[model samples]
Target: MNELKISILGTGDMGGAIATALSRRTRHSLRLRGAQPGSTSALRLIDALGVTEASKEDFLASDIVFVVVPAASIEEAAAFLNGYQGIVVAVSVSGSVGRDGLPSSAERIATALPEATVVSAFTSIWSNVIREPGTSGKTSVFVSSDDDNAKEVVSRLATELGFEPINGGALSMALYAEVMGMFAVRLAMDSGYGRTISFHAFNAG
Candidate 1:
């Protein structure tokens, strides 16, 4: 498989896990960066995997951009990449939701990067779930986007990263996916459940 060039805008646990999953499953070349100033550690980590440590310019060159920063930082980050015409997929891994259960920052991102295709994905799957993969284990991801091409791009990427992509479709469906992540994270953190859980589909028919 030809490598997909991915740029991850954050290099925390979630970002790192996503990069690792992509590296393992697909022929992907990742360019990772951190929102924090002077992220030497993040640079070093991704570089060790033969992934490039990217600056703002390098990120803009990617075929796909993963925004993994907090909701508050989404606009700022999006604004920083105003001219980059690429696929921007926001992963609301923070599990924080607003009044409508939607990721509070998605609208800002969608508006700021008007030329970019913004899709919501990797929001339902936890960071820890990607850290460890078991035999026959699977992570379910809910994806929402108005652009069918962008949705397909995310869906293919999700499958490559060992996840089952559930096409929730349209940006409006983001609320459900974001809320699901919140509940999943809380369940893992507060309850006895481990850092991961399987989202299964059972047809009653």
Candidate 2:
């Protein structure tokens, strides 16, 4: 299989964690970019992960781009990817998108990057959880994308990286995942449930 060239925009906690995880697994090339110039946090993350530093332009050359950034800056991220024709994925840990019958951040990003396949995943689970071994069994990573091929590729990567993939379906369905992230994070913190909580479906007979 051809090595996957993945680019991660915003080397914050989530982005850094993902880069470190991928670095230990695939022979793929991973690039981690800072949201701004001279960001020490990002630099530290890139160094720790042994990944290369990248610019917004580098995203155009990547096979997959993950935005582990804040929602407030998503518009800027989308604008940068507006020129990219690759797969663009958003990783929102704040659960920024809501399901109040409105367009989701994933939808907004897809619209911005019309030439690219946009997806939202890797949000429901905390970055710390990914650091633990064998935690994948109790974790579910929800993924939503309008493009089938893009979703499948992301699913495969998630699996290879030791995550249980949950196809939440079309990009619009990301609203639900985003909301669920809110509950999950809150519960993890307040209820002292740790970072291993996940959604499980059962037959309601």
Candidate 3:
């Protein structure tokens, strides 16, 4: 795969973890940007990861932009990328309903950004697990999108990050992915497996 320009929005745990993993594993040019531009945490994360900070224009121009902000902030994040005409990997899973009664965060982003190809991924995997994929074998990442090309791009990214990307069907499947994520969290916490645990599908042929 070619070296792609990638921007990760939000400088929190999930965003920072993804940036760190991609920097160490792939040749993609990474740019980190916080939901609030020029935030101190964003700068600190950039310095810590040894990655460049992204400007608004840089963020929008990236080939693949990862929206790693909180579920409640999906609208704000989507509004920021209003005119971006690139692939947007929506990492937020808002359990709440969206406009037009869309159930998944990815669909909400797609609805907001009509021009951008919205792909839902990385919603189930925890940030700690993303930073250390080898610890859990090849963890499965469910990728769902209406655009096949966009889904393939995200799947390639997942593979590059030492993950097994599962084709979770169309964008509608993202609803299930979101629910699975919630269930995973519950299972981990309640089962005493800890947050580092991940799920894998075994094909019994």
Candidate 4:
């Protein structure tokens, strides 16, 4: 894919890490939108990283949108792109969601904005792993979307970000994908592996 106009909501840790990695990897135009666009970190990204602050119209006009906010803010992020008709990739995890819940963070966002083509991806790995170029090991990113075309777009982006993207089936499968991510987190926290480790899938040939 050529230059894509991308809009990212939320400017916290994961958002900042993604922006940093993407800025280094792709020259695609990026716009940061959130409750605090004029904050210190936002200004740094705007001035130092060449990221622009986008308005509601600008956010809606972008080719692809990424919702990087927390699980609790999924509804607000959906409201941010209420009538948008483009692809939305939700990287945030549905932390409090129970096992087998249909509405994961990505699913909930899709539900809130029924018109949007939302894909669940980039959640099962750490931001640090995404920043690397896969020299050591590749992190497997699970992608779930009802729209095959949108899923393809996100898969390409994942490859560009140095991850091995795996199809997690239809949008409903996003529930399982997110649960897997949470399980990885639990493993890291409980097993003393720390956040540096990632969950990966191997293809048996």
Candidate 5:
């Protein structure tokens, strides 16, 4: 694959981990941005990873952008990408219902940024696993989007990052993906399995 310019929007755990993984595992040109301007975490990751820190224009110019900010900040994140017309990979899960009668976070982002092709991905994988992919065998990452080409691009990215990407159908499937992510979180926190676990599909047929 040709080197694609990718940008990550948050500098929190998930965002930092993703930037680290892409820098170490792939040759994609990465741009890092924070949910807030002049974020310390973003600067730390940029210094540590040697990736470019994104300006608003840089962020909008990326071929693929990952919004890894918290669910509560979805509107702000969407507003930042108001006119962007590229693939947007949404990693946060929001429970609020959108105007389209869906509670999927990706759908909410899509509703906000009508020009951008929204793809739901990486919502299930824990930040630690992204930071250290070799700790286990290939982990499954459910990729869902209304656009096939956009989904393929993200799936290729997942593969490059040492993950197995499962096609979770259209954008509506994001609701179930979010639910599955929450279930995993519950298992990790309440069931004593910890955050080291990941979900995979078994082909019993």
Candidate 6:
């Protein structure tokens, strides 16, 4: 497992969890920066992970870029990364549906940053579920992207993080995956399954 250079752009719940997960893996060189770089939470995460503040170049230089911010900040994240040419995995659901009724975070991000190969991934799986990607666990990480190459790239990253990444195929399917992600969270909330639950694909074969 050669070291993969990765950078996380945010220190919110999702971002912090992701940085912690990556830090626990010795095969990664992780750098992180927060939208509010000097905030209490960001500083705490930085200190805890021993990750220095990242620069614009650091964010862009990584083999993968994780947009692990809150759901509300998806559009803003896209706007901030408008011109970046890289593979971006949206780890947040980015809200249920836009007023137009077909707004997925991945799609909105693509619309905002046309140059980037944006992929909707890790959005369905909660941070808690990933923190301990259990051995012999059935949990899975779903990924959607128009570019097959980018999709494969993210899938490998997911594997490194101890997740079984399922290729949902074509960016259009991201809507359904997003819906599934929302449904999973709501199910956990209502069914008492808690945040640690993640979906697994059982082969019918």
TM-score of each: 0.89, 0.89, 0.93, 0.92, 0.94, 0.90
Query: How many clashes would you count in candidate 2?
Result: 0
The order of the candidates by TM-score, greatest first, is 5, 3, 4, 6, 2, 1
Clashes of each: 1, 0, 0, 0, 0, 0
Model 5 pairs whose backbones collide? none
Candidate 1 is scored at a TM of 0.89
Name the lDDT value of residue 71 in candidate 3: 80
For model 4, the run of ten residues with the poorest summed lDDT: 94-103
Q: What is the C-alpha lDDT of each candidate?
A: 0.76, 0.78, 0.86, 0.81, 0.88, 0.78
lDDT of 3: 0.86
Find the candidate with the highest TM-score and give its number.
Answer: 5
Question: All predictions: root-mean-square deviation over Cα?
Answer: 2.2, 2.2, 2.2, 1.8, 2.3, 2.0
lDDT of 4 by residue, 1-205 (tens): 6999888888777777778777888877888866665877677677767878888898789888889888888887787678898989988887765654447888788889898899999887776676664466778889999999999999998888888899889988887777777877887899877676786789779
lDDT of 4 at 93: 86
lDDT per residue for candidate 3 within 17-94, as digits (tens), equals 898999999999999888677888789878787888888899778999999888888888888887899999988866
Deviation (Å) of 2 in candidate 4: 1.0
lDDT of 5 at 178: 79
| Predicted structure with the largest lDDT when compared to the true one | 5
**Per-residue lDDT for 37-110 in model 1, tens only?**
45975776666677777778877788999988877778778877878788888885443474554443555578
- Candidate 5 lDDT at 33 equals 85
Instruction: Give the alpha carbon lDDT tens digit for every residue of 1-205 in model 6.
Output: 5677777877877788888888985568888777765767678887898877777777767777788777677777667665688888877674554334867877877887788888888777877876777665757778899899889878887888888889888888888787777777878899888887778886899
Question: CA lDDT of 27 in candidate 5?
Answer: 94
